[model samples]
Target: MVEFERLANEKASEYAYRYLKKNIVGLGFAPNSKICESDIAKKLGLSRTPVREALLELVKNKLVVVYPQRGSFVSKIDYDLVEESRFVRLVLEKAIIDIVCDKPDNRFLEKLEINIRNQKYYLDKENKMNLMQLDNEFHKILFEMANKLQTHELVESISGHFDRLRNLSINTIKDIKTVSDHEKIFEAIKSCDSVKAKELMEIHLSRHKFEEKILREKYSDYFD
Candidate 1:
């Protein structure tokens, strides 16, 4: 059964949307699986209306598909769309790294260090979910420091497929290289090496391509 906790001051639809999205991205609601509105509403203790609205929002994000005379289903992982999303994210991340290196704020740099430390902690615990959250927070902090939060939001808004792919990679591949990549990227940024930082960011963002075949072979049904 799916569980949800409503946040104070958050609308029912908004809360439902967030909870549903997290599960979808985490593969809790497996790709191409039917999403029963009434079932979800009952589990979440919400009315069908909010759950319906939440599904509509997910439809806009391309994380869910709706068909006439049928019902909603989790969208299959579209590798092409994932690649496109990665490309856009790479551009934005490189730009942000450039900005970060140009200024190299000590405060934010320390924050990155703490985040990486936390990532290592979570990785040791083999908690992929927390590690994934830390991974995102590391990049989010970079965007915040670079005053590119809106750009980060844009990347995230279109990164549903890529996000799902990443979640799968973290869960299945058992790769710890991501944390190393973050450490190296931090070093480049700390030393104000714009070129090195951008190069590292490109390599970091491009890792999904290398893992694509393996992931597809193992989770064939999850892909489109």
Candidate 2:
């Protein structure tokens, strides 16, 4: 893996957190891989203090495992946590959609459209990561328009475990399902069909059941 370099003048802990989190979530650092603080600090041209703090933050997020007098490593995919995140996301998104249905904003609709356009652009180019980023932006826009940005942030804070699965399988259900589902959700919102939009959101996010199971099996080594 290529060593990541941070921008000049940034705090080491935050930079390390972002750096390590990206690698872990993007599958650059395989699950259960040893996280040598000394090695990473050396690679990043930093000292162990900031790296240690960063790893502790990751530990609280369940993204890193630390064993006293042993070592630290990346945490494996925990299905129970994924299910919990799914529940949390479903509830918050459903509530948000219901609120949005009361009065949909044209500017928000335009934002979602632009995001979809970018999704298609990156999808056509076979850029899975970029497409997934747009997918996230679409939902972020949804919550923003619904005036529930804080709720969305709260959901995201606890979704690292589930996002690992989503990122792993983004290519599996990219265009055929994910983007199409977003389009359908948009149509429902435009028509002011709150019920339909909420149901579709449930289906869209919950549709990953089978895919997630398959990913867990295929990447057995990556799961607890």
Candidate 3:
């Protein structure tokens, strides 16, 4: 019985983490909103212990912060962290592009083209959530092509924050521009033009700084 209880608690903790991440990333839980472990426990029909464990995991991910006596709250967007993540992504992606360029694998290109087709299908269906997931998958496939699985996983972990910011940016006219930018990147990669691919990626990643600035100004209330 005790072992069963332990296993249940572990599963509950994982569920809590997923719930919190989805709500936070979806902006259902606004930034700096007080998150009570007991409340979450009650809502999920679970014990407070598992909820606490889940909250601890979120804190470790820098998604939430715990106060001594007050409670836990979602963390504000950290621009520095965003910039750092962008830099790390650029370096890793550029290295991958170099590998692909040197090898010029048809298999990689075919897989990427298939991903793009899937993305278009989702877009046509107006499935925003699936589109977002597929878009991330597209990038992940690219990194996998270069055999940077670990690096891709690291990026995937923090990608939720970037996605949230990107959601806001896509609301603007710049979203259309982004499609063109992506096309250019794809063209460079497909042509095995490593230099052009790297240049396009640099431009693509740097554009996020502008988007971040716009989002901050537009949604100043959401940030600290």
Candidate 4:
């Protein structure tokens, strides 16, 4: 079930959107599962209007599908879209790596180190969701250091399908090397090694492709 946590200052629709998107991306509402606006509205203690608006926004992001007669459903993961997202993110992140390598910041480096440490802690505890969130924060900090948060948001907007696959991977794959991968990337950045950083980023971003066959065979219902 999708859980809701109300935000004190956010509007109803904004709150609904964030809650719904998180659940969808996290696979709480599995791919292609039906979504009932009234049910969601009731669950969130909001009216249908805000929930409907939120659903419309999700539809725009390709995270939700609406059928004329059947109603709304969570969008299935689309491998092609995931590929395109990876390509776009790789290009942008490589650029970010170049910026970071040219002028590494001690402040951000420390933050990255802390993020990695926390990731390792969560990894030891086998807390996949927390590890996943930390993994995202590690990359987000890189963009923040590069002064390209807007670009990161743009990537995120188009990367919903990729995000779903990533969440699924974190949950289903036991031998996730994300922490190690982050360590390597962090070392490259800390050493101001643009060449190595870009290389590692490419390999890291492309990791999903290697898992495609296994994931598809195991969870055929999750993908389009």
Give the best candidate by lDDT.
4
Candidate lDDT (C-alpha), each: 0.90, 0.85, 0.74, 0.92
Q: Model 4 lDDT vs. the true structure? A: 0.92
Residues 1-224 of candidate 2 have per-residue lDDT tens digits of: 42566878889998888889888887778899999999889888889999999999999999999988989999998989989999999899988888888899999999999988887777766658887678889999989998888988898889888888887778555445778889999999999998999899999887668687677667889888
Which stretch of 10 consecutive residues in model 4 shows the poorest summed lDDT? 1-10
Stretches of candidate 1 off by over 4 Å are none
* Sort order, lDDT high to low: 4, 1, 2, 3
Error of 4 at 179 (Å): 0.9
Query: Which regions in candidate 3 have their CA more than 4 angstroms from the true location?
Result: 1-10, 42-45, 120-127, 172-174
Among the numbered candidates, top TM-score falls to 4
Residue-pair clashes per prediction, in order, are 0, 0, 0, 0
Model 4, 144-164: lDDT tens digits are 999999999998899899989
For candidate 2, list the clashing residue pairs, or say none.
none
Q: For residues 65-165, what per-residue lDDT tens digits would candidate 3 score against the true structure?
A: 88888889988777766677787888888988898788767887787777776766655454365665666776787888888888898886776566566
Clashing pairs in 4: none
By TM-score, is 1 or 4 better?
Answer: 4
Residue 135 displacement (Å), model 4 = 0.7
User: Given candidate 1, what's the lDDT at residue 124?
Assistant: 66
